[model samples]
Target: MRFVLAIVAFVVAVVLVGLGIAQRTVFHESAKNNLTVELDQANPFVVVGPDALTAHPGTQTVSVSGSADVYVAYGRTADMNAWLGDVPRTLVSYNKDKDRLTTAGTAGVYATRSPSPAPQRKDGSATDAPSTAAPTASVAPAATSAPGTSVANVPSPVGSDLWLNELTGQQLVTTTLSLTSGISLLISGNGGSVMPSKLTLSWPVDSRTPLAGPFILGGIIMFVAGLVLLLVGFLHFRRSRGPRRGRPRGLRGLLHVPPRPAKDVTSTGEARSGRRRRVAVSVSALLLLSGCSPDYWPSPASTEPAIETPDATAPVADPAASAAPKPGDLQVEPAVTVPQMERIMQRVSEFAATVDSSRDAKAAEQRFTGPALANRVANYTIRGTLTSQPAPPPIPASPLTLTLPQQVTDWPRAVLTIAKDSAAPTVAPMALVLVQDSPRTNYRIEYTMSLAPDAQVPEVAPASIGAAPISPEFKGLVLPTGQVGAAYADILTSGDASKWYNSFHTGGDQLVQQLGVEGQNTVRSGLPKTASIEFTTRVTANPILALATNNAGALVALALQQEETVTPNDGGTTGFQTGAVAAALSGFTGKSSKGVQRVTSIQLLFYVPSVSTTSAKVRLLGWSESLIGASELK
Candidate 1:
């Protein structure tokens, strides 16, 4: 019973506290005057407060000056809201500066003061509203100050805060105060020495409004009574169950029933003997069924299935299975011959010299089968006539050919043909390498072209015979390379360590580490400067680049423009531009992840000082979409 009462009291307390919080936020004080008094059109409200407002508990009188408004107690209730309710407030005192309103009251109040004589109205009639002009100064007696300060003198600045109306420049003095529970005041003051800008008296609203004190007192009284009653009942129960003066010991012993009985024989022995025998038989039965009884026994087997097995011998079927052999299976037919690859390379070289599309080379590349061929195809990038210079050796008797479902064109490729074996051939692993482009390597392009020469060149010239001849305004190229050391110095001076570190973390870190390892391994393998190198390539173009990629179909093809010249007269002028399609994708290998789209189109001008004259714009013009088909680029 006591536990049950405790739970009820706990729940009541929790609910009361929750209601209090909700009430605090939703309920507010309602004032009596609102904007009418707070923002009067005729006269502004002014305020005055204790000289030492921050002083510890001491009697202080606040005064209001210069207004004609009466104050009253603006009582606040739960029903009143901030927006719709009346402002509840009461003024405490006024200042004759002579301390005329010095009487203390239990509550603050608002007192009205008669306004000074009104000025003539604009329509030739007198009115209560103060004129837009400044108020006429009255020669009033000075106020008396506390102790050391004189009544006629201005007090120290610390204890007083003043607020002035922006338009009128009338001052208002503010002071702080706390109020009692369930009671809040919002009073406006008026009279002498009161500043119009600081006429406010507000208090925090009571969070909870419970039943009247009498009801709560009654409830608490009832709860105490109930607790007392409960204690009395418990005492009575104990007394009733207490030892009885006439109770027999033998009966008490029988109630307890120890395992062994006393040696002395007593009355009812026969009855006790019979009870003992029955108890023994019950114990014997419990022991006998211990293992079989549910409480002491193991659970039965579960009803769910114990195992599942798949059909290993089932036949699998796919229509494309015949088109391309699996990686491990080498039973597919051949495509291109060893001699054909050599011939392709030779043709590509000639095409590269002419800067023409190697579309046929891309077509022949797709006929390869097996993993080795696929691996080689995946790693190949921008394989064109220029890449064909270092031609590969003759293919083995059974060259590998990769068989992909997708078609590719206008790209020179390396085709490998896997041998006729049931097992797939493993391609040799390539060494890791990393290439760095420092600020020292930074290059910028600036082009200035003039009309081409009037003299015509022979058709045999590589640049003249293909497509169109160089523009007449083809001025020689000029490249100005800056010192890498100076670029490093610039980086240090720019305070860009964080940006550089972020770039390193992204992918450059791994690339650099891999490059370090490759360099070490190459030296260990007796290959010094001739170590296998991997290039990290980046392609960038003008803001017009965004237009080309997004509006490729709309852009019309233009004629090629080429030129050759030495270094130009500018900072890092080793960059040039030519109209051409650019396409590239990184991180492609035989062990590449599946389910990734790997193809894209690129149209960009290629520029490199080592490859050709950096000052010249070597234009390789073509539609990237036409050159690199919509096949995957991975």
Candidate 2:
């Protein structure tokens, strides 16, 4: 019976071990789920919707091929569609029930138009020349193109500031992301007429077998038990078969018989050695199995049932969901997302660096506009003559401290951002105002001002929930946005005597202290006795940008032109100092019969508190000054 039990145990152990090993090797499922789609219809741009990316519950790996240069970008779905505009594109979505990706073609006509001309300076010189080539439309080709039809020309989406992230590769591109709803991917072929022809998406899947380890461990235990049982059975048999001394025939017989057998020393020694070997083998097997990972073993399932109280009956409402506009309601998206703004700032920083190094006014104009462009172009011109002139403060790319985008869904969008340079800690942070005139055009920096050390930025809507653009005539503030520049100009001219002087806070205002009436009087005191000086300050023609803050006030940005003229009082003429900025800009080598005039462009950013606020004042946040123009008095 013992032998039979031992044999059965050994058989059971072998079967269990074999089954466990087989489960892990032959019965394991694929570690990842992969799906490949081949395009039957060619399109200029292919958009992969969020549904396809989030179909599985893990990070998605997307791969594209069949193009010389593959380009991929992901951003907000609304932004992608807005960029597409009237242009058509192929939309790819996932059908969970069908377990496959489906593509639909949007039908639309492709049209090209000339880009708007760049703004001109006061001297009628074009700040930047517009591209003569017609802008290529990024539209989708017909679902089934007619025979002999050439591919449609498609503009590449590379380097667009709208994208939160972008990737590109030669012939193939692969990226992994864990996407959420309302986010999408755009794929193209690096400005080629045709997009990539193939796409592969993969997601990881769990393939571990919980029972493998338990079964193997159990088998090892049973094998050890079987070996012990077999050893015991064998010993019993040996004892039974051995010549035994008959206790009855007695004591004398026992001693004589045992001695005659010679004790079978070799068999006894062999048995003892075999027992030790079996014990060692069992211990080795246990140690080997013990080192395996817990993932191989079966996990204990919870025995407690889920219990719900009255409080748990209702699901918690998501704040974002609650705040979202209801169906059929107008939903206005921000001009740009936070990540998109960051990318734009980085590009702007790079462009600024390039322009600064080369002193290229034309190149600077491409990324700058209005007062910002004027200042940069003037600086470049001054540097051309006066190489020692300091360049404008650098626009850092990283550590975007604040972002305020306009809440609108139309052309001519604006966003304000404050960025600091980690590499240059001593340099003050810069506040930039960027504008996008149309879907086809990239954002350009309109105003760049270095923030004051003690400047305080008011609370505003989050980047996700952008603030509304206030009109010039908005009365919610202590003063109208349109009049802010003129008011500040008055304060600069009349000092405490100006009626509007008290409306602003001049403490810590560097511009005010440097260009105010007191400062101008000081300049007059230094001039030649025969020379007379006059100062005139007025708002420029540049449009003012005002974005609403959370406190019902508005953050305003405007430009003022300050003219300083020095004329000889007694029919004599005066000239600028030898190395003055005015001399360099005017190109006047020596004293001129006519007086010299210098025009300084000042860009100011202010925060005006609402009328309801107590003891409110217009606070200066940032400012920039540049000698934009200088000439001999006409």
Candidate 3:
């Protein structure tokens, strides 16, 4: 019995040890190694550099004047191309003697630049560049010795490079990427009060280590031991019910009392009873051994996995009903069907025929949302002019009638057909197609109408064209890393900067204060209009940090002159107001408010660095506006 129990205990311990090893993956292996990165929080750009170079677009080359042995880190060419200003530019024109960097895609070399002194080569050969034009001028950095500036590149594990943005004030250890190379590159650098003497490149390290004394592992062992012992006790009881096989037949016969006559039945009964007692004693011994055995137990179960229920929140079709078809799918399983569409057109045509001139304009207003409806109110004019209204307008439809491809199952779609009034010079037909993705549904409706001279049609949402919908890109403005600064640019050009400044309104003052207070430190000494703002020195709010601190994130910034305008120029007012400037500024709170009032166009740039690898970033940008004038009228 003791031997059997011991064997069971050994098997249980082995199974549990295997389980513990599998659970080790949950810890982060890089916990011992610190990594820092600097990010342009305002835009999706991170400059990982100092010694590394990345693949360039169209053989685009970057010359470094500040650091020796500068490395460039390059991402995939296709992704880099998507960057607004990172498009491959022809550096030199083989044909035109005028061969500096230009938009034309042609081959060329730097007119005055030196090739890399220690460039890494793919073929394992070192080579010097043929003499070109004079080497590009080098900027002498401040003479202060930089301590521990050695940088190195640790090739990220394939498919493991993470995209990171800056958080708040923590030092960044970043890998700088430059596109000087023809292909992708990566350069790693350190951060803090000082840089590192040598960079240690690490692959994804194993996160788990043996716990102190392996307490958890030990506890697990004991639990398994107890469970095995319990199970063995039960098994031993079953075996004990059978007879002991080792007792020989001859010994049993010798020990057994001879069968007695009827007069000796009592003695025979007593002998049988004694044998039964011995059997009971043997069973008890087995139970005791099994109960104390350590090998029969198994580890206890861990936390239960979460169970999922049907998500009532989602829009689901009833199991008992037919599913709704999507527009992209072909409902008429055969070829394309124009008859159904034609029937809809007929109904529209009939409706148009009955429209009376007096009632048509009113009816159109009912269906229009904003400017479209406004056009009908005044014959499409801002003033109350009804003159020059178009006769019958042309019908609207897609340039091509599309058929659903076989690959689609249930595509969502909607169609609206509009007819023209024959009495009013045969108004054109109009068609509107709608695609449903709920709040992001795509709508396309086109119609030509005699509109006000100033009226311009708004573009359809990006989702309508089967693309991701991003907010409108700000015009005539560029972000720190060259992205179209959208929302922040609008705030800079909000037309009421002076008014907001004069009254110290929270929104307007926020911009002004950020520019004068926060922005002042970020600037190196150049006036706002003269120096190109160095993006490296600026910082903004760290959204996650704000949540951790103030419980909210707010935008603050530097403003651009080009974005702020008093009146609309070639660019429309875009929601910004235009008004005359009031010269009499009675009260001013901040020193920045005392400046002379003027109108101009500008944009805002904002960003912040990180605290931990996991912290949020702060950001800032410029604001621009124009002074009101007589020429600016609603």
Candidate 4:
């Protein structure tokens, strides 16, 4: 019974220790975030978060686990996204800065990004967003103190990241990320076509917990319990030995001396020898079982499937799964990188500089087409005539945004919304349009117009994930992008009598009140009865841009030109010739020629619905007007 009791206690101790250790093994692995990246030789990476990236509270080392086959690189994610995605493959040429390149085979790819802006309150004050650092949380801001200073600011981390790509079919990847200020993961795809899909990040619940305390404590407790039982068993054997010290214990007392029957002498000496031998064998077995080894039970071997035990010499190639949210009208991935955007923006800026210059008008000419072309030419003509000094290149304001990809088909289109700083004190920022026809073609500046003071830029997804482009003919709002111009034109030509008139703002009415037949009334009432004036306005071209907003609406910018022509009777009555008349009649003088052709170019920005279910009415946010040409004779 004593031996049996000792075995039970030892077994219990072994189990407790094994359970505690098993729990510890379960949590050794940390968390991760994964996503697919389409490959492009020109731009080959999808930048992840530069959000919170501190190591687990108790973890000694935070290492990103990945493979060499897919390749990797790293860099510090900076607050400035200046040349973000445009880093050349061999960056040494473009950048000779101290920031070293993070290449594969040495340091793996990892990065950090600037934190998001805090939300603002109704009173125009800023407020904090929710926290994003607890386990399983999405990316969010984290506070950090500069080295040697105690002030905490949300600055960009210093470190680069890596890209993973494949040659044949898509490659399934599992990359372990390192612990630092934060990181952004970059990945490329096969042939710039077959890209990664989605990512699943798995890790222990509490990544900070190191070797769990319960397991170690259980092990210690069991060791002590085991030793106590072993000593007790041995002591009992010592204390119980006085009586049957010389006699065999006989295999746990199973073998006993029966009262020697009276006929013991009758038994052969050979039989007695055999009995004695069997007894000796049993006693020897018991002693052997109870020696140096504890006989109660053996400590349980680990039943855990496997553990990610830290090993410096051979880093484990942790496998990451692949898949992503299916692309739809809205995608969380960008169509271009920061570098690509910078290039696009540069071209537009250069083109804008060319606007006030005659040296390279063709470059700007190629970019401006349709109404935009007319607007640019008219601006040049007007500015040449109106300004006393050489016009400066239009400078863009801070906080420019690139509308993410909106078109879903192979022919995806996006809009680059630039807020041009205009000299006109009341003028709102100018919005520019950029369009790319295909993957290989470069994005071209298609149009530019002013946003109204009261208008807010439509909310769109981040540059990483693009917004869906609304079609010109989309009927989701009160009107379609294509129809707004015609409708507004009809309203302008006929005034409130038009049915679609109320669906729009009172800008048309205001323009009418300002330039209506009453202006002609001046010529009608002021001029002789035989001579009269007529005013005609026409929509010169299609809407230049139709950018999608998050509310299933669009911000459409269009061009409208209104021409006022005057005529004289056979009596030949003379009328006032404004400088407009002088400019139009510069080299010609005739009494009966069309009195004067006055041209006023109008650029209008309107908010129209791009989706079908919204009941929101169309509103005109802002507009810009210019007398492009006022000729003497029509």
Which is the leading candidate under TM-score? 2
lDDT of each: 0.24, 0.75, 0.27, 0.45
Q: Write the per-residue lDDT of candidate 1 for residues 441-492, one digit (tens) a residue.
A: 1001111011112211111111101111111111221211111112222222
Any runs in candidate 4 off by more than 4 Å, and if so which? 1-339, 354-360, 382-397, 401-405, 408-416, 420-427, 437-442, 471-475, 507-531, 571-592, 610-615, 628-634
Alpha-carbon deviation at 500 in model 1, angstroms? 99
lDDT of 2 by residue, 1-634 (tens): 7788899889988988888888788988888898788753355678888898778866778899987878888887766776665545778889899899988877434333222222223222223443323122232221333322344434446666677788889889987776667778888777665568888888878766888887887778778788878989998998889556545555664564435344687788889899898889867877587437765776764222212101101111222121333466445657777767777888888889999889887777668888899888888888888989999888899899998887654556788888999899898898888877655567888888899999989998788777766655556679877678888999999998999988999877778889998789989899989998899999876666777788788888878899998888767878888887878887886776778899998988899899999999999999988899988877
Q: Give lDDT for model 3.
A: 0.27
State residue 477's C-alpha deviation in candidate 3, in Å: 26
**Number of the candidate with higher TM-score, 1 or 2:** 2
Specify the highest-lDDT model's number. Answer: 2
**How well does candidate 4 score on lDDT at residue 544?**
48
Q: For every model shown, what is its TM-score relative to the native structure?
A: 0.15, 0.81, 0.20, 0.44
What does candidate 2 score on TM? 0.81
Better of 2 and 4 by TM-score: 2
* Local accuracy of candidate 3 as per-residue lDDT tens digits, 87-153: 1122211222432211123221212211111211212122232222211111111111111222111
Candidate 1 local lDDT, residue 614: 30
Candidate 2 lowest-lDDT run of ten: 308-317
Q: Rank candidates, TM-score, best first.
A: 2, 4, 3, 1
lDDT of 4 by residue, 90-109 (tens): 11111124322222111112
